[model samples]
Target chain A: MDTLEQDIKILIIEVLNLEDISGEDIASDMPLFGEGLGLDSIDALELGIAMKKTYGIELEAGDGRIREHFRNVLSLAALVRHQGKGSLTHTP
Target chain B: MISWDVPIVRWVQWPGIGAAELGFIEPLLRRRLSSLARGALHVANACAQGCPSATFVFASRHGELTRTVELLRSLAHDEELSPTLFSLSVLNAAAGIFSIARGDRAPATAIAAGVESFGYGLLEAHLRARKSPAKPLVYVYADAPAPDPIGPQSGDPQAVFALGLLIQGDASSRLHTAFRPGTMVGTPATLQANACLRALERGSADWTSDRHHWCWNLR
Candidate 1:
């Protein structure tokens, strides 16, 4: 669980071009959008795509809980962890 | 129209400006604006802050190369391109974003005319203004070199430049600018856009690019 959380943080930094930020800077439960990390919808979309490519996890746009799932590193880590047994959307 | 004159109202040039400095572009939409778009918007916002009726003219030699190059690479590798990058890669993406953000339905245009892009962009505004002489035009120009695999390896490759001019004809404070057809055949020592901007700066009243002759004077 800890390793998954750390990896997701690194992924977020890399995929979002947050050059000024480090993995230690983003708290696991802090909000990723609006206020906490100053991220926006486009970053969410880009992160969603990056998560799918990296973990083979398909986070559908239709998912009602999609916004909740992407709130922070913790939620995103749980998402990737449990999504391993779920169905995939894109082939990649 | 080579001898045409455009009265300039307010103008700004921001060289080496980046997206981080453009907080006026709202965090949500700002995230989507590419570096090129950000630079263009930087000048656009600076020149037309509260003027909701401002018509826009966005000019760029290479509009959004970083994202376009990435999308091309993804195609080469058969990788899935993200929807965000694909959407913002258009030539007039900045102008569109500005209009939507401002919720103003004024006319906006995007132009790319090779070596004569800036000169031609200015001409485009004059043509548009001729239709409605009372309407003011906000001309914005910005360009940063395309990256990697297909970018220039050296030699003054468009250094993240952006400029804006609030143009109005027959204004109290008017700077008359004229363009004459010059016989110079090859690329000038300076970039074409740089020639116009340098003229706006402390350079001189007369400037020459590869094939266009430009002159500006304040009346």
Candidate 2:
């Protein structure tokens, strides 16, 4: 679980070009958009691409909980783990 | 000859092609700017310090072609196009970013005119300024050579550079510029920044294209 959280943080930094930021800077439960990290909608879509490429997860628009799963690193880690059971789908 | 008196209030140009210090913008927003946009916004911000609201003319020969090419390559590979790159790949990306940064809603226009982008940009700025003589016009021209993917340019490679001009309605300003149709043979396209700088320093400068002659004289 800890490793998954750290991986997601690295992925965020790399994919978003978040210079001078590291996994240590991002708390697992902090919001990723409009508040804590202050990321915008474009960033959300970018992260969705990175996550899809890394974990083979496909986010569909019809899923209502997409926002919830993308709320923070903790939720993203959980989603990756849950989807790793071969349901390579996402709601992003 | 059609011309407008674009009296220069102040101007700034990049020392040369390099990183621009745009510390004024937030890191998040700043990170998104290409080097071209950074140099452009830096000089534009310098010339527009006191005047918060004005009409803007942003001209570029190859505006964000680097980003556009990358997006196209991604599409060719059947890869998901990066949303950020797709959004910022437009010709007016720099102008749009400038408006967003300043939160100034003044009308802005972006121009691209082959090798004569700088000259035509100034002409456009004059036309827009004519509509509202009371407001200052911020004219910014920025370009790097067309990226390699587009193929080599016919002329010498132009250095990555940006020039900003603050034009007011004062008629007594020493700078006088004019352009007219002319035929010139065997001259490489002149980068307007170098010509304008020479005109400012040595009292006059002239450049020619296949269709027009642009000259700046200081009186």
Candidate 3:
């Protein structure tokens, strides 16, 4: 898929330590939390941290809208791309 | 089945400053790791596994508060705390890591009971063993004394230790132990895990050298 989707999938694999999972195994439109990836609340927190480190987007505490943003690999990729353009920083 | 009276396995000691260097307790502390990166590497060698009916117990005093304090300090300074350090600061990281590594899906509990951590951990282990007469329950206790600035006066510094017990169901493998509730004995200069280990190693019915309260009878 696109660069953003690829990057998000990579982050998911790394943070969750899902040893048997690969980027190719994750469908772009498949749900991440329940049926597809089985990720839990802890994984979500880890994903939040990874998003901050990689995309420089600090998720606000009251940002309940992130639930829709993290729906699936495609949704996460689109959100990262949209946020990456405005807030992304390259720390040397 | 494993016995409690006679020593089934000798406990090995892992001495280090933080989770990365310390043995068996790494997984629980992985999410909260900060300055204690060196400690996690210490106990990187050991592993344990068993049945689903078995329960797991882990005990530690002080836990990984060193890293927790460091993270808090960094936050107060408005600095970015290291993600690795922040992840491994919890006390249960060791048990979680061990469970993940061994692929042993048994329910596990992590306990921090101050100075009585080791004794309480052992008590829990005994109870689990009693409940599951066929499966072996694993018990692990590990700790690193609080660092300087906090000062050693709070407790013993430079003391890093871990102990593992596999309690089996077979009567032949069981060790006879006597338990007395509400007994406050002297504090042992050595680590608590070591004191329990020393008693088990010698097959002694009673041990009081360390400020610990323990008695056993081996057939």
**Candidate 3 lDDT, tens digit per residue, B76-188?**
88866655446667887766665665556767888887666776677777777667656656677777777645654222436555666666656453456554432344434
* Per-residue lDDT over B93-153 for candidate 2, one digit per residue giving the tens place of the 0 to 100 score: 9889889888888768999888788888888988888888888889998887778678546
Residue-level lDDT of model 1, residues B102-218, one tens digit each, is 778876899987656777788887778777767778899887776877775221345677888888766665555677777876744355666566555653466666556777655
DockQ of each: 0.31, 0.71, 0.08
Error at A26, model 3, angstroms: 21
Higher-ranked by TM-score: 1 or 3:
1
Assess each prediction's global lDDT (C-alpha) against the native.
Answer: 0.74, 0.82, 0.60
**1 or 3, which is superior by lDDT?**
1
CAPRI tier of model 1: acceptable
Chain B of model 2: TM-score? 0.91
**What TM-score between 0 and 1 does chain B of candidate 3 receive?**
0.68
Looking only at chain A, give the TM-score of model 1 against the true structure: 0.86
How does chain A of every candidate compare to the true chain A by TM-score?
Answer: 0.86, 0.88, 0.85
| Candidate 1 per-residue C-alpha lDDT over A1-92 given as tens digits, one digit per residue, 9 for 90 to 100 | 38778778888877776755788888999899988998877777888888878787777668899988998989987887788543333222
Candidate 3 ranges with C-alpha deviation above 4 Å: A1-92, B1-53, B80-86, B153-159, B171-173, B176-189, B205-212, B216-219
